[model samples]
Target chain A: MLTLDRHTYEAIVTHARRDHPDEACGIVAGSVGSDRPQRFVPMANAERSPTFYRFDPREQLALWREMDDRDEEPVVIYHSHTATEAYPSRTDVKYAAEPGAHYVLVSTRDPQEVEFRSYRITEGVVAEEEVQVVSALP
Target chain B: MAIEVRIPTILRPHTGGEKAVEGEGATLDELLADLDVRHPGLRARVVEEKGGTNQLRRFVNVYLDDEDVRFLGGLSTPVADGATVTILPAVAGGAGGVAGG
Candidate 1:
């Protein structure tokens, strides 16, 4: 299961809503081996197509390098689906290379309802996991 | 330089169901060519001609040591011995419709 603060979850939903039909993608970075998502890095959908999303080549390079320099890994790789269920498509499963990261999918198919789900995609298999949204402020 | 290339399950057919294969080259392009010699039609699926130039397919991503090759000089990226190369299909799909719910 993956756990994150409410603020982080809200941030992801906001990004998905902001991008709307084009599909939003980003990474939540955390300490290596920690499996905790502590930082959010919103990414540009290079494809900019409603049915597809790809990180900008240059930006992805820089961001990944930055994460490397900071000794962080992408703990959660998230993307939004504007018109579908919060599920990984066959293509999504095929491209999942990070075995250790939680793959989050948000569905903004309904403006009034947001569907947030998470999964683990390793090799050719996908397993849905539980998400614990906790309040950080106290 | 000898490098280990992690083959995705969909592309494993090209490697005779092998999950990983050995490749040798000074750069990614040469390395791909080396693999093609062993597995015919393997390069065509991953490589393509776009805008009159040959390049990796838009939907195919190749990474060297966790770094995407596109930002690392693309096909010219230098790959050293003992490095790990990963190949994946670029996956992008969702339901279809206009914006705003």
Candidate 2:
């Protein structure tokens, strides 16, 4: 199971709505080997296409370096699906390099509802996991 | 000191099951070539010769010191000793045709 505080959860949802039509993506950094997300970083979807997203290469580089300096890692990698259920597509499974991170997907297809889900994609395998939204860090 | 290349799990076979390998090159292209010399067929998976030019395959994302080489300078991106270069397959964004709007 994956756990997130309400603030972080809302931040992801807001970013998803802000980038509606175009996919939104970002990373939540956490202490190395901690597996707990503590930092939120909303990234620019380089593709900026309604059906696609890619991190701005330069921005990703800089941010990743910053995380490295802080001894952190991308514990939660997230993206939005505007017209489909929150789930990992085949491509998403194919490119999941961080076996230790949570892959979160938020679907805003329904005007009144948002489908939030998490998964662990490792070696072409996609395993949906439970998400617990907490009021504060435990 | 040599540059460190972190290989993804899928590509571990080429490196004799090693997750990270050492290579030497002034540029990413040269580094891949050097790696190919040792691993023999590893570069083809990460790069391709297209339209009379060598380009990183669409699915491949290579980062030099956490910065993507595509934005830094593509294959011509320079590398210094002790840099940590990572190669990962591109996910979600353009992976396997779009599944949603």
Candidate 3:
């Protein structure tokens, strides 16, 4: 249901790759009245090191509160794949709590070979969705 | 015919660190069954429980050659020769230091 422009998508990919080996995670927040989807705000993965990444619960709670204050929905959640390809781990499936939010992944093993994909994660199944990356803003 | 099944990074430890392995089957079910034979407990990881209308976990996504399997027929989806299937997890961003600011 959300649209991502090419520039914004590329920006996410670059950030994910820049933090290669360690996962990079961030949020995409949009104005409540905006016609198009939200813009990506890349952030450092505090729980991530060069080899591992664990989502920081404190940060996640803070983001939820901030978005609530702004009256804007936290549209999408994004993370990077360091040494591995852009794919979900069993742990990821077990922990996905958001049903409405779109989950995005960026593979950083080969910067030039960046892969961007999105999904809707539920109790135990990951449902894939089509992401439209346009050149111009709507 | 024999087809190569690619394992994602998370499942690599169970697959002996092999990225891709061989499986024989005419359909996805058969292929997965053979995969289970090679690597035990893999099917359980991919599919949590059978008989449910929706098989995949909400956070896990599977793609065949860049196309999502959900849009297709799901587990019943067919795989051809040399096709690459990727299983990806749904990722969300953390709150601090750069996001939601």
Candidate 4:
């Protein structure tokens, strides 16, 4: 199960809805070896396509360096889908290289209802996990 | 001179869970090849032969110090002593628009 603070959860949903047709991508960085997501870091979608999203390489390098300096890791990797449900697509699964991250998929297909889901993708296998939203991180 | 290469978590398996390693090469390709000599199967995961030529896998990002190798000479990018080579898997992917539910 992935436990996230309500603020972080709301922030991700807002980012997804704000991007709307174009997919939004970001990560929540946490202390190394800590599964808890504490910091929300949104990334530019270099692809900027509704069907595809990629982090800008320059920004990615910066992120990595900063993480290394801070001894942090991306605990939650997230992206939005404009026309599909909140699930990992074939492309998503194929590119999921971070085995330790919780892949979160948000669906902005519905104007009124946004679907938020989390999954663990490792070794080409996708396993959906339960998401628990709380007022504060424990 | 040896080039310092930082390995990401996803590719650490190929490096025996090493976070960083060193290799000698004048070019990025040579560096990776040199590293592969010690850590087998590491290069194959980051680069693949395409159209009879070696090309980086689409989902992988490699940098020579701060500049992305794609902007330079790619795998043939020149690397000198004390350069830091970083490897990271691209964080990407999205829906194909098939499932609307």
The TM-score-based order of candidates, best leading, equals 4, 2, 1, 3
* Model 3: CAPRI class: incorrect
Compute the lDDT of residue A40 as modeled in candidate 1: 90
Interface RMSD of each: 6.1, 4.3, 12.0, 4.2
Instruction: Kindly report which residue stretches of model 3 are placed more than 4 angstroms away from their true locations once superposed.
Output: A31-36, B1-101
Better of 2 and 3 by TM-score: 2
Location of the lowest summed lDDT over 10 successive residues in candidate 2 chain B:
B92-101
In terms of lDDT, model 3 sits at 0.65
When candidate 1 is compared with the true two-chain complex, its DockQ is: 0.23
Pairs in clash, predicted candidate 1? B59-B90
* lDDT tens per residue, model 4, A11-129: 99999999989999999999999999999998989987888898999999999899989999999999999988999998899889899999999999999986999999999999999
Error of 4 at B36 (Å): 0.7
In candidate 2, the second chain superimposes onto the true chain B with a TM-score of 0.90
B1-101: candidate 3 lDDT, tens digit per residue: 45776665457766898867787666566667778897997766677664655375534555666566777777788887777666544343322222211
User: If candidate 3 were superposed on the true structure by all CA atoms, what would the RMSD be?
Assistant: 17.2
Model 4 C-alpha lDDT per residue in residues B1-101, reported as the tens digit of each score: 68999999988988889999999999999999999999999999989987899998877999999999999999999999999999998888888632321
lDDT of 2 at A62: 73
Give model 4's TM-score versus the native structure.
0.97
Q: What is the lDDT of residue A2 in candidate 1?
A: 87
**Taking the tens digit of each residue's C-alpha lDDT, what string does model 1 give over A14-125?**
9999999879998999988988899998888887877777776556656655876798888999998887899998767756656778999999989999799999988778
DockQ of prediction 3: 0.02
For model 4, name the residue pairs that clash.
Answer: none
CAPRI accuracy category, model 2: acceptable
TM-score of 3: 0.53
Question: Each candidate's lDDT (Cα)?
Answer: 0.82, 0.84, 0.65, 0.92
